[model samples]
Target: MKLSSLQAIPRCFHTTRWSLVRQATADDSAEALDAMETLCEAYWYPLYAFIRRSGYSPEDAEDLTQGFFARMLDRDILTTADPGRGKLRTFLLTCLRRFLAHETERRMAQKRGAGLIVSMDTTWAENRYLHEPVDHLTPDRLYQRRWALTVLEHTLRLLKDEYEDKGKGVLFEHLRPYLGLGVEPEQSYEAMAAKLGQSLTNTKTQVFRLRQRWRELLFEQVSMTLDDPSSEEIKAELSELMQCL
Candidate 1:
């Protein structure tokens, strides 16, 4: 998902960092486990993409990412995460950077470990990373792009789940393309309305609502990735997200 394709959102929302971090630090409680798992599930792809771009083979990258998360979770490292230092994403990257500096040697000295921090479909991840554009983008650049894509994807999943819960899954499927830049050029409200047995005016209204919901969801997702997302900070992050696309 490119920045240009995302719907523009003009609302300001606030989120604080360290909610999960605080939970994770408290003897690794169930809440902490859930929070850590949620984060790992949402972010492993970007981390994996960064490792791959750093020249690790797919297998090695997978191992390193798993090991990194394992260490993070097991050690409750997030408790030490200082929001004052930087954004959460940057902190993760810094951790990965430090990990990569010695991971090769450490892995070679010991057998591959068991139990990934969270179970990931390694095959699915490799397939996705394999198709990433072959360009001059640095590892950091690729990670940022993948991060933005992941945030957008997470928003879509949440939105889709909401639609499914309301028994509007079919409506969501029908209207999804209109919410992005990848809409079929030939597809139009007239055609969509006809296909869905609705009037053109109704179809247009639905699309508008869908886009608005999408923007809200997008902002919500992005806000979670920061410390305290101020109005200007959110705008800047949104702009950076667009540029990543």
Candidate 2:
């Protein structure tokens, strides 16, 4: 789920960076909510994959997945998730492990998510589930891949939205080719520029801006989930995640 595409959903709807929120106006609060919802919608699939990888049945996985976010709000988890001690991927894995360890219910499939269900659209989620590669991975490997993918997806959304907000939609899409680079053969920047109808200079600028937004946004996304204020070592950790992607 590209948060860049979630223009349809207002950020005022979800409980996002509320821990850091100090906005006084109603409009600002609404935008924050929308971002929170976008974050939730963007991440559910990767979280679901991790739940399934943890040896839960499909129904169990789905419920546990639902419950995790429920706790994110109902337990004030998001508001106090800590801004420092670890990576968002690490934080999510730890949280998931703890949730799975303590959650002792069987599949009560009908008792699903409560009112916190995100209203964001999701042809992407459906397609992702239908086509996700599930073979050759033990539960552990799957969990790792889920972590990687989740961070990557979140970073993509952040970049996309930054571009859109700056009125560079075409330029944003042009930069996406770099994302799935390994999925396709590598190409020269000249080719990329020509394909996007951009000059070499504009292409370089796009890549530079993309990298900047990605790093800053990546830091924000990952560190905000830590157990401590990771103000000190957060950049190193983010650089590592970026290297993986």
| Alpha-carbon lDDT, every model | 0.77, 0.58
Output the number of the TM-score-best candidate.
1
My TM-score estimates for the predictions, one after another, are: 0.86, 0.62
- Top candidate, metric lDDT: 1
For candidate 2, the per-residue lDDT at 242 reads: 46
- Candidate 2: what lDDT? 0.58
- State each candidate's clash count: 3, 14
**Residue-by-residue lDDT tens digits, candidate 1, 1-245:** 34454456555554343355545667457765676677788889999999989988988887888888877766767778786654678889998898898775665443454765778788999999889888978999999999888887878888889899999999988888876644455378899999999899999998888877887787777666677665556667878887887
lDDT of 2 by residue, 7-126 (tens): 221222222243333121234466666655655675677777666665666656667777777666556554444454444555566776777777875433347554545542234544
User: 198 in model 1: Cα distance from truth in Å?
Assistant: 2.2
The C-alpha stretches of model 1 lying farther than 4 A from their native spots are 1-18, 27-29, 108-110, 181-183
